[model samples]
Target: MGYKNLKVSIIGIGRVGLPLALFLENLGCKVVGIDKDSEILRDVRKKKMSFDEPGCAALLKKTKMTISPSIQSGVRGSDYIIITVGTPLYNHIESDLSYIKSVCTDLCGSLKGGQTIILRSTVAPGTTSYLKNFVEDNTSLKIGKNFGLAFCPERLAENQAIEELGLLPQIIGTEDNFSKNMTNKLFNLFGVELLFTNYLSAELIKLFNNVHRFTDFAVANQFSVIAEKYNQNIYEIINMANKNYPRGHIPSPGLTAGTCLRKDFGLLNESSSAPDLFLSAWKINEHMPFHLVNSAKKYTKIRGKTIAVLGYGFKKNSDDIRDSLVPKLLRYIEREVPKKVLLCEPNIPKKNIEGFKNTDLNSCLKKADIIFIAINHDAFNKETILGKIKKNAWCVDLWNVLGQKQLVLRYN
Candidate 1:
């Protein structure tokens, strides 16, 4: 089908779905974004973006697609229903499928033949197969005969979704030929490579992509801890090791976390026989905040001092805070009995910040006795941050964004 003739409905128009909705709408597809959140719906109706995604804000203003809070009405006449709802981990590290189950239940009444259902959320293995069976069992439609279902994972990084949506190769996982052909034709419009696989492989592909990066980060974090024990500079070591050697490419350590990396480890190892690898990586990365606090305590006193956390977002250039390590870092700092804690997240809107006072960079720097560069955003560079802070203030920069050459240092 041609882009102009295709009609698509995207469910859960948050980080994942909203970009796809705008991208498809830009392609001349009749797109409808469905979200249960009334606030998100209101923002979309007014062409206001609730979060940050490069190049999406301009597209949002010109987007002519329909956005509504009602799932049934939004998905009624759509040729494709894409589910991008979040699947987070519970406190016990088990995969939570309540969002997926709820979406499927609400979609049962709207289930009809000749419609392609694409799951764009990151999920555990067998989730797509289970959802395929669930849809067939709950509705009168049979897969390949009247209905189509596929698992096409969203692999775009936040803040790069607008560009990557059309650039990255798409992996389509389906059980039958009907879904395979439908999704193939749909994603082919992007003019990128397509890899077709079964439902389980596609699910595993998404999980593995994140788990691999998470484990790599753990290696860097562990190395940083070891370097600190001997008072050696990790930045110097990494720079020497990787400067001219092609085989020596080590990632610098920081607060390694996000909604996907932190949770996907548990999702993959939840049922797999090899759980130790994931558990070890999880421990190493999770211990970073505590390690930073303990290390700072050894250098200078955190008790009754103002502590400033430079960035709250998980990664740089993104405003997504879901599963960010900044909260855990805050909790650890709070236990140190600091008199005040100042938060400065430039990417996140002031209204979205809760339970803490969001201050400007100058205010945070001036008031802070100790500063922790939790995230390495470009705005927190040496020129912007170094000249502003107190000359004698203790700085803990895991990201090494300030060009200090050492993890913890003071100008004096």
Candidate 2:
């Protein structure tokens, strides 16, 4: 089917689904976004976007797509259905397939004979096959004969969803050639590169990508610990190490916080049958949060002192705080210290965090006895709060936000 004739329905209008719907709609497809939350549906209908992604709101408004709070109403007459629901882990770190199963069961009840079902959620290597079996058994429909199934993993950054969606090469796979070609044709509408493989390989490719990133960041975090032991600067050491001709690709050290990075590593480790180095990478990255808290405490006397936090988001220029390391650090300090804590997040509301005093960038720098630079926001970096802090105040730079100074404890 052509892009203009494709009627697509996206389930779960969160970070991934909402942007994907907008991108598909921009490519001339008739798209409908489905979410259980009425507030999210209302915001989309009123042209209000929750995240700070580029080119999202304009596309949503320009396409004039339908956003419905009911999933059944959204997917009733759609030719193509894409499931982007979350796959969180349970208490034992096992992959929770409850959401994915629910979507599949619902779609089976409303199964169209020639419709295509695509899974955009991340899962284990054998998850796609399991889903296919579940659908075939529950719906009494023949797989690869009556309906098509495929798995197409999403690999976009948080703040750069729209730009990366059009730029990054898409990886897709299916159980049959018809499903493969159908999914590829749908994705090629965006005018980007495409890589077609088997379903299991596509699932493993997503996991491998995140595991590689976790390994690199774990190495950098370990180096930061070594630097603290020798009273040396990690940023300078990393810069010098990257000067080599062939092996000069040293990554910077910082708090590795995000939903995909942390959860994907845990999934890979849980699903692994043999021992591997990825497990070590997972442990190191998981401990980096507490390591940062301990390192900050060693440099500052936080007892009975006001602690000022510079940023609360996971990364720069984004408002997503999932798996953010700052909360762990704040909670640790609050348990150990006997003083008031002042959080200074410009993007997040002050009411979300209890006992947090809301202050502007200037006042936080002037009054804080110990300042922690958790995230490297653009506004916080340009103001140069290092020189403005009190003479006796201690500064903790987790992402190397401050330059080489006498009062700052540079973690990376």
Candidate 3:
């Protein structure tokens, strides 16, 4: 069937699911967006989007797709069911499949014989097979012969989700030709390239992609540390290194935030039985927050000091704090530093942090003895507040907002 004629239903209308539904609808497909939360459905109906993804709100308004709170109602009678639910980690960095299982079970009960199920959530290498087994065991329905299954992991940036969805090439995987064709047919409508492979290859592709990023960020962080000891410009050094022929891809230094980098590395390490070199890179990136805290303490006394955190979200131009590095820094400050910590996250709600005063950016900057730029928000580039900061105060540039100042101690 052509993409325009395929009726698609998206489950878990959170970050990735919401945009996917809207993107499919924009392609002239009949799309139904579903989420467990009634409030999220209500928000979508009212054209209220939660994230900073580009073109998402406008797409939601333009598509006018059917939004439903019931998961079963969304999946029934749909040609394709795309799952974009969260796969968060629990204690010891173990993968939690509770949400995935719940959604699969609900779908299996009502799924028709010819429908296809696509898992867009990132999982371990064997997760697709495991889910297939679970679905067959519970519902007594054959997988492949009865219903199709595939994995098409998301590869979009946090802030550029909608644009990336329609622009970036997608990686799809399935066991049979029919399933692969169905997956490719739907994705092709978005005008993005589709690379087809087996299930395991696609799963490893997602993991390896994140691992490469983890290694890059670790190298950048290590270079920054070395440059700080030698009193050199790390950014300049990185630029110079990139000038070499055929051996240049210097990554920028900053706290690697977002849900994928930190958690995917943990998944890779846990899945590996042998000694993996990539795990060390993952450890380096994971320990970055503590490293910044120690560096902050070495330059200035954090005890009894008023520290102002400039940004709380993981990265700039986005307001998602799922696995943000700022909270880790805050916890370390509270444990070691005997001072009051004032947070200045303009995008996130005040209730996210406990016992900390969420003040305006200007107020926090003026009252703070130490300013930590957790995320480089655009509003901070204004010259008035930047000039007003006390010269004696230490500035921890975690995101490299300030280039090179006498009082600035750049962690990235």
- Winning candidate number (lDDT): 1
lDDT of each: 0.89, 0.79, 0.79
- For residues 1-412, could you state the per-residue lDDT of candidate 3 as single tens digits? 6548789999888988898888888788888999888888888888988666778878876777888877788777889999988887777757887888898778867888888889999987788988888888887667667778899999887778777887888899899876877777788787888888888899889988987888888888877777877878777787688886478887877787678887887666676676666767766676777777787877778889888887777878567878888888888878875567888878765554546666888887777888877777876653635676765777877555665532255222
Which 10 consecutive positions of candidate 1 have the poorest summed lDDT? 349-358
Candidate 3, clashing residue pairs? none
lDDT of 3 at 399: 55
Which window of 10 residues has the lowest lDDT sum in candidate 2?
Answer: 403-412
Clash counts for the predictions, in order: 0, 0, 0
**TM-scores vs. true structure, each candidate:** 0.97, 0.94, 0.92
Say which prediction, candidate 1 or candidate 3, comes out ahead on lDDT. Answer: 1
Please report the TM-score between candidate 1 and the true structure.
Answer: 0.97
CA error at residue 46 for candidate 3, angstroms: 2.3
Compared with the true structure, what per-residue lDDT tens digits does model 2 show for residues 1-412? 5557799999998999999999888888889899887888888988888766788878867667888776677887887899899987786657888998888777778787777889899886788898899888888677678788888999898878999999999998787876876787788788899998888899989989987887998898888878878988888888788876487776777777777887887677786677678777767776766776677677766688877887777778678887777787788778767477778777765555445666777787777787877777876773567567777777777677666522255321
Q: Tell how far residue 326 is off in model 1, in angstroms.
A: 1.0
lDDT of 1 by residue, 57-126 (tens): 9999999888878777888978899999999988877899899999988888888789999999999888
**Model 3 regions more than 4 Å off:** 1-3, 229-232, 243-246, 349-355, 382-385, 405-412
